[model samples]
Target: MPPQPSLSFTLPSIHDNTKLDCRIYQPYHSNPSNPSIPPYSSSSDPSWPRHAAVVAHPYAPLGGSYDDPVVHLVASTLLDLGFVVATFNFRGASSSSGRTSWTSKPERADYMSVTGFLVYYMHYLTAPQNHARSIEEDNNSPPILLFAGYSYGAMVTLQLPPIDSFLSHFASPATHTAFADIRLRAQHLAEEQSTMSADPASPRKSLGMRFGGDEDLSPRSRGKHRAHSPDPEEKIRRGVKDILSRSKFIHRRHHSPSADRGTERNIEVPCLENVDNLIRFRPAYLLVSPPLGFVTNLATMSFSNLWPKKRKDGRTKNLEDYTKREESEVETEAKLTANPTLVIYGDHDSFLSIRKMRDWATKLSNVEGSRFRYVEVLTAGHFWIEHGVSQELREAVYSFSAGLVKS
Candidate 1:
């Protein structure tokens, strides 16, 4: 059977920004109206925009959704602790609106939009109950905004500036320049992609000459024709096209703007191939700059990556791209809060090896000092909670998260 999709709903947000559609995967019993509710439910409330923690789904376009097991585990855990836990799709995320692109500045805006809207909606529907307050008055409310995510979502949560401070700063026209750097970087990348494509030796450009860019690569008739020449010698051809496309896709996803700005400097990944040629890699420190710049740099590098174009030939000058990706990953991971964080990676995960994941996490923990957490599930390929994970694993998740939620 196919998987069930998440439930979708629209909420009006602050500043009259676009009304956002979010996929809200709520716990079955959090609402008391349903007795069949499990232990992790607070279902009795009839209030609108229930008191809950918001789970920001990881890289939604990359098969990560509100229903992803890691996200579900987190959301479900919070729900059982008596919080109305809901995970929403970021715009361009699965079922969410807008074009599919990971622009950090814009995505962060969307996240705050969700936070603002939820706070306002809850206040409007249930007066005298304020769920959000200026950071100065953060403790004044209960069931406060708890934004959580795995990989990219983690970055989003970490990168969120103090909303009240940001709003206050915005009242003055002088501070608008804070957003300019990201805009400039994006423009630079766009220009770079176009210029790089112009190089005559580029394999893509070379292919364009023979096939006629109009035949496949050109904006017109793009994706209209297959590149494989179906001649009798077809068996002689290899699967280069397919493999190259997949590789390109991963690199492209990292180029998204959403994953590249603000407090999004802290990136959470299941695993990393930490050793290369037996040299262990260290996570880079991101505290070298002001919070905004530090976060922006970390964010830019976390979710997006520059593609390393390696032809079947022995040459590889994409060293610049490789260096950039490494720096980005290290800084983001290293910049995590001193409060211990749990980094979980599956052994069987195709993305990277357990050793690599461990090495990166170890180095990151070193940066954050004693306040670091790491977890690895063996025989699990990027998803232990699926076939490989047992009930014990689920219980462990509950036990761990339960410590964070107050009854």
Candidate 2:
């Protein structure tokens, strides 16, 4: 048979009604009817057992977008590694709508929207009610989801704290207050634009908060909140942890010898039964060249610089507390030391000082389990424009991904 095609489509900017350009690179397969192959019916319905990886581009204001060569390279490599890859242009980048913001708030919404789309698509293809038809395929397991990025995109990737966080957020409509905030922000921005415009007759456009094509993201029914309940964010975090525990039980039960193996592909059916844990999507993250100094050190120093008068009085105590906190955090970090992360940089990177990069690398290397690796490409700079440098970078990424498969 002929080759299956890659899919391109649009999703509305979660921050506004503008359509964002997105593409899905279909997995390459020699046997379409193989029991392991995920069946692709529509862009929304992909049925099969395969993992997915989404690549976010670099800083948009500096001309980054889905079309960036680095982004395409990573997507292509992931596809070769048997991952269903997705890449998209962020707001005001290339063909996407709205201008990129300095604070990166709007870009976060764009990332969340893309992630929401991927989760919905997974549910559509794998869930019983949305399945096109069932086949007597092998006992194929669900695909693992992976997230990878370069530079600024890598920064976004690192901000996520493990895949379990997503599993919690997606479990139910009641837990998605953050999404509701996005919709409200979108509406408020639209109203502000309307007031400033000269023409009043022009109709206002609104993007509906829909998940899985038909179901509204907003909670359909209301329940009374307990007077002693924690804040909304904390509640959602707890909800996700609880859902994962229950989902794990369902997973063990479905895998029992007496259960129907073929039918267990609809395993998420149990998760959907509980109104809160309705979505069954999770992704692991691979971040490259995240700016540690920019995110952490600068903030720590900003206060000291702003209030020099108070610095001397508090310096000793502050240093003591900071050291204690770091020591405690290191103890916790021991638990995740086995979770490997690879950090690659050019020796002459323009965006990072040699001292800062070296210090970061040293710290990563000292982690107990040694799951962190630091590699410096000789004489190369920030963007890797030097001759053959891009290829070297690609090899490093591909090696890291291949290692994940083996481990």
Candidate 3:
């Protein structure tokens, strides 16, 4: 089958103000008239098929982006299985702004921003129109969010905080904040999409036309604005309003050349709501060729022993801080274990030895009540470029996703 159509847009990183290029692909069978493809759920049906997936590419410094073939393969598989798949560039990748960081914290925040946006977008699109009725009443089943990554991206995915903790950051963001801005953007786009789904022949505006202006601004110009612009909050609000106004004009001016002009539908900027009740997702995980050992540590600059020695008076404070960090890590690990997790690697992998990978996988799978699982292809390598390994990878992903749908 041919590739499915996708919506191209940019999302701001909560870490910095840099924009990350992103795309969201709806399933091929979303159209009502496409009888060749088996229908999973009606596009207009606001209740079922609330499954969404985010696929992350490999290392950014090594030329990985949303267009990576491995990323494409996984995303395509999920899309075929009725998932609204999302793929995005990390900072320093492709047209996204900013340089990659050594500590990896900023990258983790970037991932969080995208995930949060997807969660809100899904909620808005699937939510019932009746505000009085509970959203859960329309759909008895909760939404499923699959977080999948490859190579360095997989490592970053594993280190992410639990779903609840991550969603808490966006629960009730203050007005004029970056989190608030993200929620606004997601709602606007979701409204546009819902409209299009109702009338498939509508003339759609590109995200660039809708959210223009800043894309042409140089990084130096942005830096200057940050340095000199007082009232940055007001500036952000004005920018959003200006973009919407420009989009309205563009839509009217380019309405039609051969047919009678009609009144354009007013674009409603959705009001922000307390999203805590709207977001209730069951999380699943998929890791493809996740790196391990010393190389991973060096790339992330994670040296535990590099901390400065504490004074005798501060020893207790230092110990308390360490304990808190350890507990946070343990909490994240426990969440991963409780979810449906799958790690796929190759025995002939180049970056990490088979022995170390086997040991890590075995240890995780052996945890009490753990749902973690793994698949190690005998002759495949890190890239899965071997003759038949790509097929194996696809099959494994298909089976995992099929299980999610059935359950």
* Whole-model alpha-carbon lDDT for candidate 3: 0.73
Clashes of each: 23, 7, 0
TM-score of each: 0.47, 0.57, 0.77
What are the runs in model 3 whose C-alpha is more than 4 Å off? Answer: 1-5, 30-43, 46-48, 129-139, 203-272, 302-329
Encode model 3's per-residue lDDT on 1-407: one tens digit a residue.
21533456778888876778877776755542253433222236644477899888899999988878899899888877778888889999988889888878888888889899898878777554435235444665565799999998898898888878877767766434567667767766676566666654445412111232233348998777557755433544565565445442211122223344654544424323475347477899999998877667666664553575576776654466567757865875686789999999988898886788898789889999999999988788988899999999999999988898778
Please, what is the whole-model Cα lDDT of each candidate in the order they appear? Answer: 0.41, 0.53, 0.73
Q: For each candidate, C-alpha RMSD in Å? A: 20.9, 16.3, 12.3
For residue 333, what is the lDDT in candidate 2?
40
- 1-407: candidate 1 lDDT, tens digit per residue: 01121223443333233334453333333453343332221112333224445666666557766556667666655555554444556666654556434446556676665554334323322222222322313443233344556655665665665445443322221111322211222122223223333354454321111211121136443444334433211221222223223321111112223554553343332211111111011111111001123333444553434445565675454665567657755544544544324555555555454455567567766662544555666665544456646443455545545544432
Candidate topping TM-score: 3
| Candidate closest to the true structure, highest lDDT | 3
lDDT for 68 in candidate 3 is 85
Pairs clashing in candidate 3?
A: none
